[model samples]
Target: MRRSIPCLCLAAALLAPAAVQARVAQARIARMHTPVATLEQVQVRLDWAEHADSGQLRIRAGRVDAPALGYHFRDLTWTCPLRRTPEDGWQCEGALRGQGVAQRALALRGQGAAPLRLGIHFDVDALTATLAQGQARLALERRTATPDLTTLILTRVPLVWAQALLAQAWEGASFGKGTLDGRLAIVAPAAAPLRVSGPLRLHAAALQNADSSIVGEGLGGDFQLAYVGSAAARVTVAGVLHGGEFLVGSTYVALPPAPVGLHIEADSAGAEGWRLPRIEWRDGDVLAGSGRARLAPDGNVRELELQAHSGDLGPLAPRYLSGWLGVLGLSGVELRGGVDMTTRIEDGALVEVTAVVRDAGLHDPAGRFGFDGLRGDLRYSAEAPVDSQLQWTAGELYGLEFGAAAIPLRSGDGTLRSRAPWRVPMQGGSLTLSDVAIRPAREDAGADIRFGMALEGIDFGRVSKALGLPAFTGVLGGEIPSAHYANDRIDFDGGLTLHLFDGTVRFSELALERPFGTAPSLTADIALKGLDLARLTEVLGFGTITGRLDGSIEGLRLVDWTPVAFDARFASYPAPGVKQRISQRAVQDIGSVGDSSFMASLQGQLIGLFSDFGYRRLGIGCRLENQICTMSGLSGSAGAQDENAFTIVEGSGVPRLDVIGFNRAVDWTTLVQRLLAAGKGEVAPVIE
Candidate 1:
């Protein structure tokens, strides 16, 4: 309606000269062209009574098209009463109707086939017009004294009414819901850039791009915008936005109920895209920032420089970081901190970052890891050397608690390294770290890290208690030559050694995958030597045995810290200084655990007379896979005469007792239950 009224007013002004000469007049033009619109088959008729001050006027056009403004109309007709004012200015007011005009103009208003009321006042030097429907109105004015300038006042106008105008600056943008009330001044000259400056108040606005990657909903704001369209266009907008949610790529922001201040200035860079000279954001004390950035033609950020601070990060994750945090499976993480940071990016890559932290802390409700009392000045640079330090009062990894340590760091040439070894106290021992180097992830590669660690005199008894294992006292001390982490996995170059039960236990080929993710996995191989079987059996609550034990567990795998597969073998062997003796209760328990039968050299009744016996050798092995344990014993083969038998104990003294196993395959879960029952003395044996 607003667009068509201007052309109608022009037609009236053109007929003014002829109207003054004749009381009744008719005129026709095959075609007419004006700066605003083009008309075909135009006709005008006017009737006046002699000595009257008003006349009946009618106008018709076969077609009116304004291609530059995205408006087209057919068979347009207008009827009005034209009156001459005391100042001799011509004024006309009436309802305008057309085929394409009413539909295109009222499409956004949802008014079906309703005529638009248009009123125009024109003198030789100045003109004003108003187009209205219901509560919505648009008024336009111009003067010959300033032909290139036009002033427009809008009241309760639907934002969709300017879709065509918005497309001139931002292609593929559509306004879904909203209304605007504002005043605008447009200066467009034939030889200069088209400029529009306005103050607009937006209410419940919603907008989205073609791909919906960028979107806003329930947005309200008071904004001042200045836009210039030329070969190198520029735009500036400053506003206070309240009660909205917007998403851009992986960043989603749910604006607080309170208003947030914002300002931006940008200039078009043609094919290179756009350059933003300044950006400012403020949301009370929760967040504040200023930045500059460049954007590619596809709307990806190419480069950025930012300096920002936050007084409280408690609400930061949900308000601004939820999209990314949810993607990384850390949605339940909580943070309480204060931080200030400065960062720079070049060519879509991060080049430098510096941050100061004040008593910041983070916790994961799932208990994977957490830290507290962190204070630091952390810095990273890709080109020049930089130094920094960070200290934490306490932390935890997995379920192990550790005391605080300070780390000195230096970075240059795209890599960061520790300046010296840092020691952390855990379980009455210290874990020392050295030669730590880190390379941050890039577009084409994941993060890379290498470090060396040494553990000294860690109390295994306390560790067992903490892990809910049976009591065993020893020291765990070892050095890992190097460890590397990449591609979501960590591999240790060396191994850990533990001293337990007067023996040595070594672990090698250790690797972990997805340590902080769902279903974490671990793989390792363990070898044991010279173990005191008497002590080991006592600690495990098994019947007493006095012997030296050796064992090897290879190809061990655990998922979620539960044993899934292994090849394990344990044996008791005779030694010069060691007694290879087994108690009667131990033999019974072994038979119960291994599903073996006893063969005594003496009578069964006589075997019961002995409380203990000496053993020559005792061995058992199991290869576990897919919930089944393939069992074997010393000198046993599948094709042997006693193919179903496997010895669990072999005695050599008078009235010797030989314990043999008949079952060769056992369910892993059932075997575990048997072992637990035996350890609890729940299995009762009968000698027959």
Candidate 2:
């Protein structure tokens, strides 16, 4: 009885009008059910002549439930007058209104037959949906029991509006506002689950999230999805993103305004949630990858195998991987390389990485390092406890040039170590690397490094040129038993020896902090021995001083390549090769540094008459701290207990000059200025 009323009323409305006594007719359907939808308490009212063929029909106060779609509609009201049609079975025109995110406004028309048929047309803001059905499937178990439906064929529908029908929400991510237009077909079996399949085009679409994990603007693409069943459903997603930025963790990728193609196919993996047999991402001239992935039972990423290639890695770094590099204090650096790599991940962690670089170049504008013509094939894997080999052609670091090298690494026990010692030529010197141990990249503590370095027969002329230091000729050689590069610092355990000025200089307790950051710092202790005084004076433009020189400088610190603090003293060695003599100008310069006048063995009247003088001994010292220089070391100390007066240069023979220093504590700035001016021959005469 409930099933027959819709056909009866539809037939009556389609028939022609006739003259007869007026009567009102109405009936109610307790329930109407489809595989995907259900409507209850449907009321139908008819108002027209009893003898007439056509009448006004109204369906109101109904509710619908589509649990699979997350939709519940209440207060559903439909009012339309059905009339007899010459060619059509039954026709009615009015509105059907419901309260839900799905079809809210729909125009309904139906026909009466063995199986009912209906046309649903929906139109709303920036969206429209139309369904013209040929026939509706009836359930075999209850064909005549009540209103039951099984299948639907949508001839026309808007795709964007269909997104509201899907019950899905991605955590921490969302798509920006836009419209999608296209078509789709929905199939529901009485015994099987519902399925939706089609191609939907995104128009002017965009996406953004709080973490910027998936951000894109002005994006337009087409995506296709087809689902068969929930238990073992195999769904493949294929789409293209027009332009956007994509970042996963610290790895970032960018796209231009042009289209970027992507394809993926996933199949049920029983206990393991899903397995992707094919995956692809393509961006012309930028980046491309092909891969496969697996998901755990809980839908978390389990494993991934990918092969990617990049033509240029320089521009790709700043937009995507800058944050990761910043952890190592390498921000604002430029990187360029033709890169080819294969990465394998297992248990949601990176297990293997293999990469080959072609024509790689990295440049730091701050001038710490810049290298080109670099190439290498580097490999690391958890499976192979050892047996990794890396070969590079050449590189430059800190203005020091180096030759090619091949390094083989062994890995095990949570560390990667060099299988054998490695040696390379750097700036006319050989640098040997041994016992190099590096932590794995995947470890939480960060990939720190520890190694030992030995230098042999390195020429200081080249070193001076590399460091932009003042002219000094020497051979530098040393061995540091241990050096650690971790926590943004490089510290050495042993000393470095330099053969300079026909003598040796030893440096110890060296450390470099934040080598690539602003205000890089270096600290060390230095001991100088047997340096030729005449050559040193000539090279530094400090007038002239005879005899060999020896001294020690302690507590030396350099911030941003400038000496900030140190205690240094140099005295002429007693056993020396050259005659002990001091040029007149040298005395004047020394006088200027000491803030004093010249004292002479000759009478004061004879001092001004000598062009130069012989000196018995010469020494100087300064303890610099807080921009103040405390000076000491004068020949033949003053008999008086005056802190400011000390004899510096002791005269030997006739016309000998004795220099007395009157300032014990002097401003470093003033001393530096006086020394610079004296080197340029700008010192004024000192008369006391």
Candidate 3:
């Protein structure tokens, strides 16, 4: 075993002189201490025939400990024949056995348990030793002529054997699995810096730091490493990693099957920090980059500069960008593009960025947004003004497709501003954006953006069709005086206006949160005035009603575009120029949807005799919260005879018919189902 080699050499050196003077010689050492190791209960015996060329030698030790080297052995024994070569050099080769040798010793013992082989050759100026078990070998050589130098050769060696050596360079670093085949030269002189230089071939190697923030698995590489340990330590590594995966914080790299070249040179910044002066990575057509960075003692990046270009980004998402995409809630987003970029950071803040994009495209599989044919050069600076331009051929937002547009921008003093208004065509109309300014996020602040927008002649029919809603005819045109975005939320300063069914609809106090993330939410207040009820009902597939309509929806909130809470009220009032009439089918559908019963001044059975009815006024309202709708009708207060009864319709002609609802509170879902059934002409009237 490697642990006991030094003791064997010591025993041979002490006894070689005695062997020549006497045929049989023995020595017992209760305890012996050396600079590298300590030995206890050691015994040595040599037996030689008179005038013979060789002698029988045996050495045993109860314990050997080298705490500095992380080695401890117990019950060590070696039996070999000692010979004096023609050159007057000593040689020994024999079986070596020991407990607590290393992990490999345990593995070798489990596979048939053969004693290890140790061979030693030493002269006045040089010494060489080799320890082997099975097919694995470790050799050490030192020379008195160069007392400061030691060379080690390893063949089929388990990486665990170097755990202590690795810790000397990176404290608390541990080997998980793998093997090594390489050679190393160590220069460690008294009262001087220790230096190690080596070339190593690793197979399926794995390792992790104490906190597990840095991890590698299934790593295979051929590398050249040089490290110097001093007040300002330096390390250099150059290699080609063939296969593996590693994760450092939010950045995860899944190496390709083909080899990727890497090189880095770093100097110690502090007790636990590093300053990288140069770094290079090459991965064929998938990626290539070079960068320099400074890391703080707490492992945060303090300064960085990088220049990178990708020939193709189709494969970059799953392999290199998954971590960032997942953290931003854009997992599974697809990309096809080529990009070149340069970035710089100082004091943990981005100071400048420049990027050029070529025929790029991105699509979210969740159907939120998509963009194609993007060509641009974008430049940003925190200290100086920079001008840039960007253009996209087409895009889609919430399923509404829009045609191409270009944007000119200038950035300075940490703010980017648009130079000209942007007009995008959509659904037979245009959306114009102006007065745009943006500021990127900093360590202490979130992103801030402000913009103004105007909509002109947007066809609501096409909008409804695109959104899979009822085919309502209208024109949308509005101006948002200002809009601001910050902290993942957007707020509009003004409202949108739409002309629908010969009336005007307004949306105010509009705000949105997490618009592009999971579970987006929206809140707004809506008001409608003088809407043609006949046209509105016809588009909704409800039976005909000729009247004027007014409504308001307050405290409206939707999560994932589904109504969660609102107070909505709609009413019909007399119009001097418009006739107020309701058809029989409309009365029946309204009764069914409102869960009301029909009452006639003459008789309930005679209500079916009339094909239509005249109504002075009608109204309905509901305050929805917690999945319940508190229903109200024309009679806003409780009825004198029945507390729950409320008049839904008031008749004004002969044989007048009125609809009365007895239920005041209904499940929102049930009310929606009833409305849907009525719209489909599946509900029948109840007469009382």
lDDT of 3 by residue, 1-688 (tens): 2424555665665676677788778888888865455789988888877777778888888998865455677887887888876666788888877776544466444566666778888777777888877777888888879977878898977777777666655667788777888898877765666677899899888888777777889999999988777768788999999888887766777889898999999898657578999989998877899999987654567899999888898888877888767656677888898989999999888899999999999999988889999889988889899999989999998889899999999999988889999999988899999999999878798789999999999999999998999999999999999999998889998999999999999999999988877788999999999999999889877788899999999999998988889999999988888988887878888887777887777555677887778888888888999989888888553221477777888777876778787787889899999888878888787777
Each model's lDDT = 0.82, 0.68, 0.83
Query: Which residue pairs collide in model 1, if any?
Result: none
Give candidate 2's error at residue 619 in angstroms: 4.8
Question: TM-score of predicted model 3?
Answer: 0.81
Return the lDDT, model 1, position 442: 74
Q: Per-residue error at 527 for model 3, in Å?
A: 1.8
lDDT of 2 by residue, 618-675 (tens): 8889999998999887545552246668777777888656777888899999998998
Find the 10 residues in a row with the least total lDDT in model 1: 634-643
Task: Give the lDDT ranking, best first.
Answer: 3, 1, 2
lDDT of 3: 0.83
Q: Per-prediction TM-score, please?
A: 0.77, 0.70, 0.81
* Model 3 ranges with Cα > 4 A deviation: 1-181, 189-192, 202-218, 637-641
lDDT of 1 at 2: 44
